[model samples]
Structures are given as C-alpha cells and as structure tokens.
Target: MAEKVTAYRFDRIDETLSQLNREDCAIIAGGTDVMVLHKSRRGVPPKFSKPIVFIDHLSELKQVYQTDKDLHIGACCTYTELLEHPLIPTPIKSAIKTIAAPAIRNRGTVGGNICNASPAGDMLPLLYVYNAKVLLRSVNGDRFVAISDFIQGPRRIQRLHNEIVTEIILPSVLEEGTHVIFEKVGNRNADAIAKVSFAGFMRINKERIEDIRFAFGAVGPTMIRSREIEKKLVGKTLPLADAEIDTIVAEFDKIIRPIDDQRSTAVYRKTVALNLLRYFLSLKQ
Candidate 1:
C-alpha cells in the first residue's frame, strides 16, 4: 500500500495560496478526475504520492459574474451549478448535459475539466469555440492565458506547480449567438466518454453569415479549433452554404489528427467528425 496523503481544506483564499508553493502538493476540488487517477482497490482509500489541498469550500473561488466584455466563471463552480444558472448560454449548457450522470455532474467542476487537460473532455470543445480564457493565480500574482494555449495537449497543461486556475473567462458576446449546436458520440448515452464531439455556434443576419465558430474534441492533441479556417464561412451568403460546407470540411480534415485508442479508431473518428460538420452546416439554412 502507498503512504496515505494528508488533505487540507481552507475557507480562505489567502490561506490556500500560502500552501501552494510546494511542488509535492496537489490541488483538488470535486475529486472527479483526481480520485479516479489515484484509485486503489474497491475497498481501499485512493493511493496518493502527494498531499491534496481541497479548495471546493472556498467561497472566493466559486463566483460567477459578468462584466462589459466577459463572463467570469470561478474555478470551483460545479457542472450542476452552471447548468442551473440562467446566465449560462445554450451552447455551454448543451455540452455540460452530455458529460455524465446527475451524481457526477453534481460534484464535477469546470476547473477540474479544464485542468485535467483531456482531449476528450466534453466542456473543452465549447470552451475553445466560445473564445474562453483561463485565469491562473499564485502567491506571486495573477495571469490569464487563452484556453487553447493553456491546455497544451492530451493530459498536459501549462500551469506551474505554484499556480492554480482561479477562473474560466468567456467572451460575453457568446450569449448573443443566433444558433448553437453540440453533440457527443460515446458508446453509451450515460457516463460515456466522448469518442468524437463537436460544439458550434453562428449568427446569421439578413441571409448572411455574420459570425461562426467550430471546435472538435477527441480528434486531436487538444480540442481542434482554428480561427483562420472558420473564416472561410464567415460573411458568406446562404446561397453559397452548400459549396462552402465542403470546403470548410476539407480544411478541418487537414488538422484533425486522431489516433487509435481503446475506445475508438482514428478513421472512424475522422469520418464522423466531417459528417457532423456537414450536419451542422445543413442546419445553417
């Protein structure tokens, strides 16, 4: 058996940051992913090589607010909380609904999903399409990074040992989207991990595509989103939608690099991804 790790819970943010300098310590909130990764036998406590600092109880890190330019979702906010909040947009709510069962959603958190850095994380594709950013903090100071840059690759994040993600920031303009769509393909309807998933949104005005976004999960090192590629459809008229859809699909195909995993094959993922893109485009009409 591994040595039992100590757990710390602090009500104050200041007290939490004071203990964050140690490289051997881990930060945990919902324990949704952490507990699974450090699992032991069925009847045994989870095996841990480092101590855990629980921050879910900190009220300072559970805020949800909006400013002139952005919606700030605190790191400790759970999936259930966001689902119930009236301010959350349809695109985000749709994605969160497909995550897991009610019990897991009640405990799993937004920050946990982001920091876990899994390419298949359901929330990631929407976060990428919505122009989200992550707020990282430490005793030294605070900094914000684009979500695309923060989650470097599968199971990898750019956070330092001393830094903790305090919030997930999204552009306020996302709430005004004219249409939104989200879909996750998994083996089972409940508690299944995504084999391929997509989150997209667009605003049409006077029969012209004013704005559009697309992001795909479980099909790349990180969730695949490219602003340069999405520009192809923006400002296009509805009459040109059919032809443009094929062009957009081809553009995305070049960047969606998947690999064979226990859950799925690369070819199946790529085929379904492009098909979903086609279905999403068809809806634009």
Candidate 2:
C-alpha cells in the first residue's frame, strides 16, 4: 500500500522557493487541474515528496485592483472572482462566464490556467487581446514577462523552477469608439474547450482604423497575437468599398496555422476562424 502524502503551505514565495529548490514539491493553486492529475496518478503527489508548497494562501498575491491606467489581477484570483469583479473588462467578464462549469470556476484560477499554457485555455485569447503582462517572483528576485513571451509552446512556459507568477497586468482601458469582440467555436455551448477561438478589439477613427488587435487560440502551439493581421487592418476601414470582407477573411486564413485534432479538423478550424473574423467585423457597424 502507498504511504500517506504530506504537504506544506507558505504565506510567501521566497520561503516556498527555498523549500522547492531543495525537495520535490508539487505546486498547488486552485487544485482544479492538479486534483485530476493526482487522482489519475499522473505525477508524484506532495505527500510523496519531503515537502510540498501550497501557494494559494499567499495574500500578498491576492490583490485585484485597477488604476486609471491599468488593471492589476492577482495570480491567485479565481475565475469566479474575475467574473464578479466590477472593474474587469466587459469582454473578459463575458469570456470568463463561458470558461467552465460553476464548480470548476469556483475553484479554478486564472494564474493556473495561464501557467498551464494550454492552447485551449479559455482566458488566454482575452489576455492576448489586452497584451497582458505576467509578474513573476522567485527567491532570487522579481521580473515581468509578457503573456506572449511567457508561453513557449503547447503546455509549456518560460517559467524558472523557483519562479511563481504573482499577477497579471493589463494596460489602461480604451476609450469610446473602441469595439471589442470574442468568439469561439466549441463542441458544446457549455464547458467545452474551444475548437477555434478568436478575439479582437479595434479603435475606429471616423472612417479609418487607428489600432487593431487580433488573437487566435487552439489553432497553434500558443494563443497568438496576429501582428501581421493587425498591421493589415490598421489605417484601413474593414469591409470598405475598396476592400471586401472576403478579402480580409482570406488574409486571416493565411495567418493562422491549425492542425487536425480529435476535436476539429484543420479545414474546419480555418473555415470557422474566417467566419468568426467576419462576425467581428460586422460588430463594428
């Protein structure tokens, strides 16, 4: 029979890092994902190691605030907390509602989702649209990493062994005349992983476009911000008399590289991505 597991909790990152660097430790946040892994025996549980660090109790990283210029979301905040926060961006709030079941949302955290770096992670596309920055801390020091750079590949990140994400920072909100949209094609209407997700926001200047952001998820190794697509849309009115909507759709098709998977086929994801882009453009009307 297996021996009972042991666990440790800390109120700080430095103290936890010191413990982790010396012994095998499983990082536990919301435990939504980790619990499943543990039940499945996928990894060594905390009890199996000499010491395990529980970071969910670090109150220093539990702050959720917004300044006139930016929104600061603590890494320890749960999805339900984000959904209930009054200052959260409307687009983000809406997206969080569709993330998972109520039970999962109640226990799942934004930091864990981001750190997991899953391509189908529900909030990642929203983070990309806002150009979110991740704050990471370790025993050595602190540093900030952009979400685009923090995620390296499928279920991977650039996080160091001792580093823990402290918070996510979003730039100040945009003014009026800026439209935002997030659309995803999932298997079911509720609690479904995105087959292909697209998120975009743009500032329209009279008949022209000033700034635009586009992000696609579950289509590549990571949720990607399409600078190429944004560059093409900037300074130009979409669905213009000169540029047809079909042309913009075609451009998006070329920008994303999707693969055939169990949930969806490459051809279908590409087609859905184009349709989602068109739907976003229509919202500007």
Candidate 3:
C-alpha cells in the first residue's frame, strides 16, 4: 500500500512560508526535476517523507527585475522565460539554449538546476563564473549565498528544510568587448547531457588581457575555478606564446579531476576539457 502524500498549494509567497514554518516541507517550483528525481515505477508512488508546497504558480516566484547593481531573476522563471527576457546576459542565453529541447526548456527552472547541484548541470559553470548569488527565503527572513558556496558537490546543497531558493542575483553589467565561450561536449547537439562543459570569459583591451575566467563542469565535484590561475593571465598581452598556453592548460589539467560515469569516461572528459581550454585561449590569434 502507498502512503498518502500531503501536497500544499499557495498563490502567495507569505502564505507558502507560513505553511512551511509549521513543519519541514519540500518546495516544488517547475516540478520538472522533482517529478523525475522522485519518479516511481509502474504507477507506484515513490516514498516521500516530507510534505510538499507547490509554488510554481505564485507570481512572487516568477518575476524578473533589476536594481542598480544586479539583475534579479525569480527562481521559478523557466529557461524559456529567461531566454526571451532582454536583460539576460549573452553567456546565460548561450548556455540555456544548449539545454534540452524546447519542451524541457519551457519547464526547467534555473532554481531547480541550482538545487539539484549536478556536476554536469549546464547552468552551474556559467553561474560560477558570473559571480552569481542564490537567494534563499524562509519565514525567518531572506538569505543570499554565493553560488560556489551554496553548491558543495554532486546533489549536495546548503539549503535548510525551511528555506526555499527564491531568486538568483546576477551582475548588471558584463564588461564591454568581453569574449565569452561556452561549449558542451555532448553526444548530440540538442537534448543531450554534457559529457564535459567549459565556460570561459576573457576581455582584451588594446591587445592586453584585461580579465579572464575559466570554469569547467562535469570535471570536478563542483564547478571548478581557480582564482590564482586567472590572476596570472591578467594584464598579459594577447598572442600568447605556445609555451604560455601550455603552462596555463597544464595548471588547469592538475585541477580538472573527473570520474568514470555511465555517460562518459574520465579520460575522454579530461581530454575534451583541456582541448576546450586551449581553444578558448587561442581566440585572439
């Protein structure tokens, strides 16, 4: 026999939080990930120990607004929503377009992606490099956490039972002339999970490297980034020598730890990742 699951639906954020405070509850926004994650076999209900609060329809969780310093994206906003919104950065749109086909994009929310915390999650590498922040809300109040700190490892996150990630904050401006490269090595062009992915941002001013950032996914426990290595490239003039590129790639090679998974092998992922890094650095020449 299946135990009955209690599901709560609210039209307002405050009401949702009020209900959430009475007991530990799981939040469902864009239930796409949750449904698949908790799917059961042959019509049998998967065991769910926590009550569920459905906030997908709440307006509070579907907004996109910008302040002087940041672009605020409601956690429930779907990939399609962000794609259509003009304020979304090019890098974000580039990454979102690579996600599953239209059906999944229409239903999948970035917030769900953040909470899932998969190493291959398409949004993670971009978010990590963007210096994005995740906002978690509860009856107590609101809290913001750096994306890197919020996502510890595969399927691991820092959310409390009472907290729901309500919004994502992104910087309002990307420096002009920034070159962004986002590549996903997948089996197919569309609707394929990334075997390995890389997102690199570089800005060159008068042939001098003004800023550079590299983040790799599916190659580490969390989105992998090294501030130390990025600092080494700052102010270095472009048309870098082969030896310079090799040195940077070698440094990244040491940190790009991958594992053999059903989707891909460790060696393949590592090789593709380094290749992508080399390609990103080869942009100017």
Worst 10 residues of 1 by lDDT: 171-180
Question: How much does each candidate deviate from the true structure in C-alpha RMSD?
Answer: 1.6, 2.8, 1.5
Over 18-121, each residue of candidate 1 has an lDDT whose tens digit, in order, gives: 88875547888899999998888887888777788998888877898889768999998999999998777766787788789899999988999999999899
Off by over 4 Å in 3: none
Q: Tell me how far the alpha carbon of residue 230 in candidate 2 is from the true structure, in angstroms, after superposition.
A: 0.6
Which pairs of residues collide in candidate 2? 5-47, 6-47
| TM of each candidate vs. truth | 0.95, 0.89, 0.95
What is candidate 1's CA lDDT for residue 276?
89
How do the residues 165-224 of candidate 3 rate in per-residue lDDT, one tens digit apiece? 999998745657677778998899888878999999887888898888889999888889
Candidate 3: residue pairs that collide: none
Write candidate 2's Cα lDDT for 1-285 as tens digits.
Answer: 456766778766678878766666667889776666456354644232444568887887678888887899999898888888888878788787777888888888889889888888888888988889998887778899999999999878888777888899998676567777788789887778899998888888786888888788998889867687678778876545425666767777777789999999988988888778777776644
Off by over 4 Å in 1: none
| Candidates by lDDT, descending order | 3, 1, 2
Clashes of each: 0, 2, 0
